[model samples]
Target: MYSDDIAIRVNNLSKCYHIYERPQDRLKQSLYPRFQQLMGRQPSTYFREFWALRDVSFEIKKGETVGIIGRNGSGKSTLLQIICGTLTPTGGTVDTRGRIAALLELGSGFNPEFTGRENVYMNGSILGLSREEMDARFDDIAAFADIGEFIDQPVKTYSSGMYVRLAFAVAVAVEPQIMVVDEALSVGDIRFQNKCLRRLDEIKASGCSILFVSHSSTMIESFCDSVVWLEQGEIRDSGRPNEVVRRYVDYMAHGVNDSGNKSVFDIGIETEQSSNGWEWIRITDQNNVRALDDYAFKRIRVKVGEEPNASRLPCEPTVIEIECEFLALKPIEFPLFAVGIFNELNEPVIHCNSNNLGTRMIPIVDGQLVTCHFKATIPGLRPGKYLLAIGMDEGLLGAHQLLCHVYDAWVFQVLSPRSGRIQGGYVQVQDATINLQIMKGDRQ
Candidate 1:
């Protein structure tokens, strides 16, 4: 959780529950008697205190991909509930910057009396979407749900697949800025699961921030930007998806895992807050469309600082939308410097660094600082955590830096885009214009 680039800023966030042996003891805590405190007694009750999330704080910038990784009871669900506003934190503030949709629990927000069509509109509205928006994507949702005429049937009669299909259709169709999915895919059919993954790619493409929770380290390592490994309601490590997953996989594989809670990377959130604004980009070399095997490091920059919602990044958005005041920190680097991504294994992944791609070579006026974005398409990583590395190619010799003991910045897991004919790559050369001409030879 980044305290700086705060999408959902959790300031000292904590959730606590009071345990009681007897049901009557619970009645006392909610409605304590004067006798409980006046006797100078420690409430002489067989009750315990359990903290789901203890003093946790971090910021998520818009469009940043994040993964929440932990064992069961590590407070992953509790933390997500707080973020999704389903459960109130015992202490601290959670500020959500934009529309949010959470696949936290199956059927978390469903009305048994409502039909699939009606529920889509209802659920979309509840998730901060307007009726008009839901109406626009009505057919799209139905097609994805694949419930056929069940769209008119009451949800009370829905099979688990039908229920999830309807719920998921509505969740992703709402165009959420922050989407939190918690093992929602595990329940669906493999075909539906793959469909949801495809939709996820579209959502990310549309600049939605996401926080995902899953027992599958493969998912976290392959798809999330950075993962938070929690243990017993506290964060142990947060960084690249693959590195954290590797540690997690190793722990599970070797059965030496004793933390029974958080992940291996105890690296806390560094980096300050970042603005969220975006302009779509396609990566390329100066020559032309890029091939999959090519690694041509091309230089490009985008004129920035022209969009709204510059502050407060959503949880899983890939395109960052944030505001900037343009401080003249000549050669200004950030809290975590450049943000990049990798696969699940501990190998060198791709990254974007000002230090590596020298953009300030030409002299500038004393205080002329303008906002610009540097985007590069990172190819060749096989869907897990390649050890994340950062460097500054400052007109010098090989100075590759695996910053921090764990270099835990830029955590992203790849979700294959749904577009069937066109697959993975930076550019879209498949699109074209078709023109028909009259027959030159006057053939019949």
Candidate 2:
């Protein structure tokens, strides 16, 4: 039994569909199962079972807002449909308390032949409201939809935006205790979207539980109290919004597997000792090295505020140290040392090169090791994992020959305390200041 405070309880909820290779296979499967059963033989199957959701379970407390995030075909929509009672589950059950309303796919819960005003009444009736009650709320619904005279036109004549507006209006007008929204707000204009968000905020304030499915991490982080990440019809992770969203972003950007063991950006490096006169290696034998014949990265290390993994503040001073060595038959001059920081998306966030900074490495002999250190205050980085790439090159800007380079040599995480200001986008602008100024008009 679920506690009284729980708004929704999903227990091992699963949905499966039979996928037949051909249309005839479906009929064959249906008839063969019964025929085999009658013959006292094992049931024959002509179709494969496709599970859209498998053994998913979670609970949402009353008045809580939860966000669902996942890639395409991840069963986010299927789960929402099952929770809203529009689709039946193949296994397990979902128990929900209080009235539930959903804004699902575009034009859902709306009839094309019915006018917008008429459809509102129809949807209201489905939500357990009387015609008299709907009439009392009709003006408020129309005003919220803001479709004006278009409310008199058939839904078939409405655009996607208008359809969403009317659907959202009806869903919220019933004053549901539980609300499910699946990317419907994304179709409206920016202004209308803000208005809808404000309305959702008011609803949330009124102790309504909400299930929001959106692709934008910013939206999830901003509005959701908790988050669930789904992949391949299974729950990948579920927890606080910041933590789950960060992991989801990392998985999406770096292709991190569900097991969290394989990293797409990880490359094998060679670091074995050699008796040859010139050998390329990593500074630490423990680190894997992918070395080139002429150049190699010896080691890479990062430190934030004297701590290895405690980068709690965005404005903290961070240090990156790279040790490299080159084996040359003759003397080499003006080698360039560079280090770049990339976010989970593999996009460069910070790049620094000795040549660009007017600092050149000393002339090198046959087997000399060079160490480069970089120190800077990291601009506010969104709370997520990042990578460091290091390289050595031969000339100045625009005409440099890459001797050797290692991508994603080191991985690090930024841990910023949760705050509304730090939730969106990749970078947190530290020391940002804003001022408003006014100039007096000359004309009267």
Candidate 3:
């Protein structure tokens, strides 16, 4: 028996379909199997099996909102259908503790021939609501739908937006304990989407569990407490929203048939380092010289510990140095030197520059090399590979002219101990303290 706190439990869930090459092949297979068995001959199969989902397992606690993210044909809809009881699973089981209201596809449950009002009543009845209960909630549902005169019109004449509006309205009107929404809000306008989100927030406040699917990463990050990423037909990753989303973005941008020869960022230094301590790792050398109209990056270097080629430990401090040379023969004015660190997903984690720190570059003589250095310890960086980016600009923060910007100028990795506190996130908290104080009046 499931505990009271568990809303949904799915174990070894799978779905499969049979594909036949021709219509006659399906008919022959259906008949030949039975006839061959009677004739004491072995039966032959003419169809191929396609597994839409395989051994997918996860659980949702009560009042928790979980987001589902995946590309098309990733079995997201198939899994939702099985949970909503619209489709049967070919293997495994899903145990749901409460009534489920789902808006899977546009115009799925509504009858095209029936009016909007009729469909609402039919859907409510399907959710186990009596006629009197539907009558009591009819006005609220209509107002929430806001399709004014179309309430009396046939649903077949409704637009996609109108269909989603009515379907979402009916789903929420049933007051289900579990709500499943699948990219339906993408069709509506921003204002309508905000209204729907507000209503969902109210429902969630009443202890309803939500399972949402959307392509908007911002929405998932803002609304979901946890996330599940699906790839091909299985769960690729599941955890905090920010971590999973970043990995998913990286996979989509870099991992698709990527040959080792063509990388977005190239490492200039050799892979192996000398055994000498505190060796200088050159990220950009003279061979990587690409000149802009104003200036160009001459070289980039980082000083590390004994194992200069290996991933740096989080406890170690490193120094990054960059050199830029003027391309034009004229004097440059107000030049800015900048450096940034980005994850593999191209999300910027840190950005620092000389201008922001109130340090201005001295007037550069023609063809003179200018150097800038940064030294710091990144305390809580989790174990992963990161990229360094460098750029030179002309003006202030908002109105800067880009002289030259190089992404992935250098690649580095962070190595953390297994028992470290920075286990699964992008940033680490170096020092954290908690204290409790008692009030005199409430003291026990």
- For candidate 1, report its TM-score: 0.57
Task: Give per-residue CA lDDT, model 1, range 359-406, as digits (tens).
Answer: 443432334444334444333223222223222222222443222111
By lDDT rank, best first, the candidates go 2, 3, 1
lDDT of 2 by residue, 224-306 (tens): 99888988899988877755765576557544233233343343444444353222334432222334476766554455555
Clashing pairs for model 2 are 269-289, 269-290, 270-289, 270-290, 282-298, 283-298
lDDT of 3: 0.76
Off by over 4 Å in 1: 1-5, 30-32, 36-46, 256-444
Tens-digit lDDT string for candidate 3 (1-444) = 788998989899999999999999999998999999999999989999989899999999999999999888899999899999999999999999888999887769999999999999999989999999999999999999999999999999999999899999999989999999999999999999999999899888899999999988777866888989887779888887765765565456433222122334444564334455434444343122233555666445565443333445453344444433334344557777777888655577788888887886776666666665665555456677787777777777788777766555667777775666454566765556889996678555
Q: Comparing 2 and 3 by lDDT, which wins?
A: 2
lDDT-best of 1 and 2 = 2
TM of each candidate vs. truth? 0.57, 0.70, 0.64
